[model samples]
Target chain A: MRPSATWRGLLRPGDYIVLAASIALCIAAGFGLWRGGTPDGLIIRAGGEIFAETDLSRARRIAVPGPLGTTLIEIQPGRARVAADPGPRQYCVRQGWLSRAGAVAICAPNQVSLILTGRGSDFDSLGY
Target chain B: MTHSVIELTPTDTDRRIARHAAAAIALTVAEAAIPLPLPGLKPGLANIITLVVLARWGWREAAWVSLLRVFAASLLLGQFLAPGFFLSLGGALASLAVLAGAMRLPSRWFGPVSHSLFAAFAHIGAQLLIARLWLTPHDGVFYLAPILGGAAVVFGLVNGFAAAALLREKAHAG
Candidate 1:
């Protein structure tokens, strides 16, 4: 039979729901595992007082995150300089190197956050 | 089915060409509905429709519909000649490759249903590889992996059923 260049009707509502749900599930799964709960990329920390400051020209962005609060930061070019201030727990230094999605490292009490946001703009183009 | 006005043309050849183009357009619209933050990679549902056309018609006709759909849609959607446009063009080309491979199979080796799924997998794999390498500027690629893979399986099954029904209907009518 010759191919009928027909306009098949719209997908039934139920079918649309099914396909959409599948898509959402896929996106969620990827983000949850790949970038969920990680913080190595460029992150913002909450500080009542000056805790530390780092130059932005050193970090390299290596990955893309799909969700909230996830990054992978590799500090090699320059170390983030820490400053003495008031907060509580100065655990900021204790937070180790970050390189995976969906993981976070923070300093409690001081309220300083150190996250890895996939591609650090500092060295994005430079980091192949 | 409610085909486009082109199908109502008086000329036979034109009608046939119009019908094929109409289907291609319809499939492209369906593909557009599946949204993602990033462009290029999709479940390749449009390709399944193209493959079905190839199976029902000839490869030449199918190729015409496929290219028209890609070029026309890219222009209409305003992705004309952009990087995403190239990705879609590459996807259409790769899909044709899969369709050719499937058509070469023995008649009884697998039904149209299975063929749709197979072609879908191939299309998704190629698009994924492209996205991982090109489109994704950051960790965003990670988010697309599961979605693309899962969409391939789910939509593949839906398209498979549709293809099988189409083939079965043709057989009975003949």
Candidate 2:
């Protein structure tokens, strides 16, 4: 019932295989899943509708009208943010610089939101 | 009016299962006292008892001990039927499923270490899946996979060694 006369016997070949495979999986996920590319596009939604989809390569300011008022979205060369919103707290404005893929800024009271898109979408849908 | 008495007698196997489950539950309770930075990150010291039981008895006995430990420990920890309880149940089921298969592997090459490692990986994977589907509902939960996987590997190996040593000592004694 014992692998050896001593209790301190080294791991078997199958044990080594499992350990190696587990380490390999850990390394693969660590390196593969975390390197999200910089976002290149931004989608603006207002009043539960798509206001505009623009490329992040351009630097411009777009004002989208909603139920409350216009929410100003400022887009830089590679990032976007809610520069101003009718929402009192300006929580979306505080988000500041949506540069990563799947990054989002929502001005709930203004009914406007901005989402940054990279080479690919990181999630199917997101809500706060 | 005559009252009939129902006799309850514990079988040998029942007694054995209870003994092993008590040990596993003790480990589970003792392990909870140690503080860790993360919520779900546990060394899973109780699983060493499971591995030892599997090595000594069989997978059925191990499964019984494992499941009993989860339920009993949850009750003892006052987390019964809570989110933490479901997570523990999910993990225990997943690890038991893997061990059911791993136990069939050739014992010469695959023993407590291999079974423990595979079960640990399955344990975390199932816990994360349940957390994502039921609790967090966000794919971002997967971002914790690498860190959890690392812990699984380290703790699984350590527990496997502990189980192997216990089995060796038992073999020497018995």
Candidate 3:
């Protein structure tokens, strides 16, 4: 059967409802997947294994030993940073403070890495 | 020595399905040539053919055209039996399943646009599920949900309009 409506008058009431619902679902997915909260703790890894996981509620210093030397991590309330590293470039130390969820500081030469974790902070993979 | 020859006869319905599947396959191969800014993001131009077929024929014919397009197009693109082939198959199957149910909606209200939107979303949703389960095997794949969802809405509407236009033209001509 030939369609009763043309392209000009194609959108029916159901069409409008579907369109609205699609756009709404898209918006909801964007917000739900992309939005992240502040990080609550920091995880330190050395030699490809988890070395330490601590909350950012108290100020503390963690020294994780790796192949090269000790990598010092300084944690302040709600934030953390790499204080020192034996890695040549000091890339992790230069990364400064990591406060947001999913943030990372990697000392490749020293084989140490720090990652901030919180609700909705999960990441599939991290690249250099 | 004597050789026996076998002959095959295809009925009218078979020819019609072949014709529609050929069109869908052509569009699929053509669409693959277009450069995409992001991985897994496609304009889904072939979906237009599926929507058109569904509107002109029925869900079974549309399913045949869509699945045939996936298989034939993959073979033509030299991606047969590859990971990309499975992705294409998954998306086609998901979308065809959705269209089957969507086709039952009241014609006075729902039409090509609604069916297209539903199929597009289902297509991407299934692809993402497959990628997470088999390919990436990580929850991080969900991070792409927003971008893909948005693409589905946009492309779904565009393809839907294209199908509507084709139906209109055919309606006038026939």
Top-scoring candidate (lDDT):
2
lDDT of 2 by residue, B1-174 (tens): 999999999999999999999999999999999999899999999999999989888989999999999999999999999999999999999999999899999989987999999999999999999999999998788889999999999999999989988887898899
DockQ of each: 0.12, 0.47, 0.61
Note the chain A TM-score of all models in turn: 0.31, 0.68, 0.68
Q: Pick by TM-score: which candidate is best?
A: 3
Clashing pairs in 3: none
- lDDT (C-alpha) at residue A8 in model 2: 40
Runs of candidate 3 with Cα error greater than 4 angstroms are A1-8, A41-97, A102-116, A122-128, B1-5
Decreasing lDDT order of the candidates: 2, 3, 1
Tens digits of per-residue lDDT for model 1, A1-128: 33452322323334344345546656777666554432233444554443333433464433212123223334544333223323345444344544443234554454545544443222222110
Model 2, residue B145: what's the lDDT?
93
Residue B39 miss distance in model 2 (angstroms)? 1.0
Worst 10 residues of 3 chain A by lDDT: A119-128
Docking quality tier of model 1: incorrect
The CAPRI class of candidate 2 is: acceptable
Report the TM-score of candidate 1, chain A only: 0.31
Q: How far is A127's C-alpha from truth in model 1 (Å)?
A: 22
In candidate 2, list every pair of residues with a backbone clash: none
Query: Candidate 1: RMSD over Cα atoms?
Result: 13.4
